[model samples]
Target: MSLVWGFLALLYVSTDGLEPVPVALLAAFFTIFGAGMNVRLERSLERKGEYRPSRKTLALAILAGAGFLAVLFTGVIPALSRPIIGSFYLGIAVAWATRLILLWRWEAKTKRRIYVEGTWVGSFYLVPPGPLQPAPA
Candidate 1:
């Protein structure tokens, strides 16, 4: 997640002295990865009417993507090794971090429990516990 990327970026910066292109590119990719996970979680919350990221949040994401795209194509980064693109990447990092903070808040906000099944999940119990059995050992 973001923390992992942040650690790697710290390593990279220690060696590279904040090379903007690598820093921005790595952070941008991490943002994308985390965002996808955020969206899926948000959708699950939506089913229970517990949460939905505001339209303003989506706009911020779009703006972040557009900013990165602009920097990606403008030749400023490759030609000048500009720190400006680093600012764009910082925006992405901060936005993703904010989304994560909101997610923690939503966990408390959920009115009832819900469930999700991932790729390997075959079955699960939806209702409450019936009885407790002692451990075999």
Candidate 2:
């Protein structure tokens, strides 16, 4: 991750414009630094052994990351006007909405099991069912 950050920093700083390089370098450097932070976060989560995302959710996350990288590399965010940037953000919002719906459905359908006191508990819902309402009095 640091190597990737170094490469990006080198490329960005080597560009012709020196005036904004300092500010852009700081921003991009920290943003790239987040890749390393994400690794640390994933490791800590794995160690906890209590949280696991569904395969579908993981795949969607990968796709979303790839899509965002594609958008950035295509220069859509930098080259476009404000409305285009807004549209890009609008698309992200739509994607997030779809992801939320899919995640909720997946959670509602999937069951997880954990062992406690040498016995297995097989009923776990990521999205637990809502409380039942009494019949109309």
Candidate 3:
């Protein structure tokens, strides 16, 4: 993750030496790919009855991060020329906070479900239902 952001930073700095839109497009593509992978992984785990972040939560995080960046770019926060330079860090913080809150909520829900189900193993593991068996003669 750091590496991707680092590469984006490098691209932004080198934009004057190259075409900016193309570089920006590539960065956007990579970001989308990473986000899609995260969503797919979360859903897959959720289907197994494991605790995972919800898609809505993930979307919220993305929106927050994007909003932070948009604010910085539009000069709403007035970071001066530093807006372009500092936007990535600010965006990262926003996204991290979003993800953390999402995970917390997901864990809380999982705990509640476990309690309601009366499971002995707590919330970490999910067991599928099976038919009862009779003793052999």
Candidate 4:
């Protein structure tokens, strides 16, 4: 999902060329969707005592989003002409597919562990732990 959104973002960068506002909007949508999916996956993992992203990882994601916006606004990527939007989408699709395949393979190779605790009131409150732990009590 992250890779898919990133591919779309790259396509936007390389194609008919979204204006800053549209690009920013797309970025926000992708970021929110990606974060939501991460939350869902983390919850699923918690049920099995398996993988979750750390605070450092979330912080890095925030930093990366900021940097991506800065680079876009700074014109680090050249403006794309309208003639090649199809090719841009094609390229992005290929890149996204390849990335997804690779990530699937990598994940298959390594097992990850996750631990989560929650307090229930009117609403559920999730509390994720730090990266390291002594042991499960």
**lDDT: which is higher, 1 or 4?**
1
Which lDDT value does model 1 have at 133?
29
Query: What global local distance difference test value does model 2 have?
Result: 0.40
Show model 3 residue runs off by greater than 4 Å: 1-41, 48-80, 112-137
The residue-by-residue lDDT of candidate 2 on 21-123, one tens digit each, is 3444444544445444334433533356344445676577568757865765576665323232223333333333443454344434443222212111111
Better of 1 and 2 by TM-score: 1
Candidate 3, residues 90-110, lDDT tens digits: the string is 334344345445545655555
Per-model TM-score, in order, reads 0.36, 0.27, 0.31, 0.33
Clashes of 1: 0
Instruction: Please report, as a residue range, the 10-residue window in candidate 2 with the lowest summed lDDT.
Output: 115-124
RMSD (Å) of each candidate, 1 decimal: 9.6, 15.3, 13.8, 12.6
Candidate order, TM-score descending: 1, 4, 3, 2
Superior candidate under TM-score, 3 versus 4:
4
Best-matching candidate per lDDT: 1
- Model 3 gets an lDDT of 0.47
**Positional deviation of residue 53's Cα in model 3 after best superposition, in angstroms:** 14
Residue pairs in candidate 3 whose N, alpha carbon or C atoms collide under 3 angstroms = none
Model 1 bad stretches (over 4 Å): 7-40, 48-81, 111-137
Judge candidate 4 against the unseen true structure and give its global Cα lDDT, from 0 to 1: 0.46
Best by TM-score: 1
Model 4, runs deviating above 4 Å? 1-4, 16-49, 76-137
Select the stronger candidate by lDDT from 2 and 3: 3
Give lDDT tens digits, candidate 1, residues 1-137.
44444444444335434665666676676667667766666675565543444567667856865676576556556644544344444545555685666566654464323333332211111222235522222
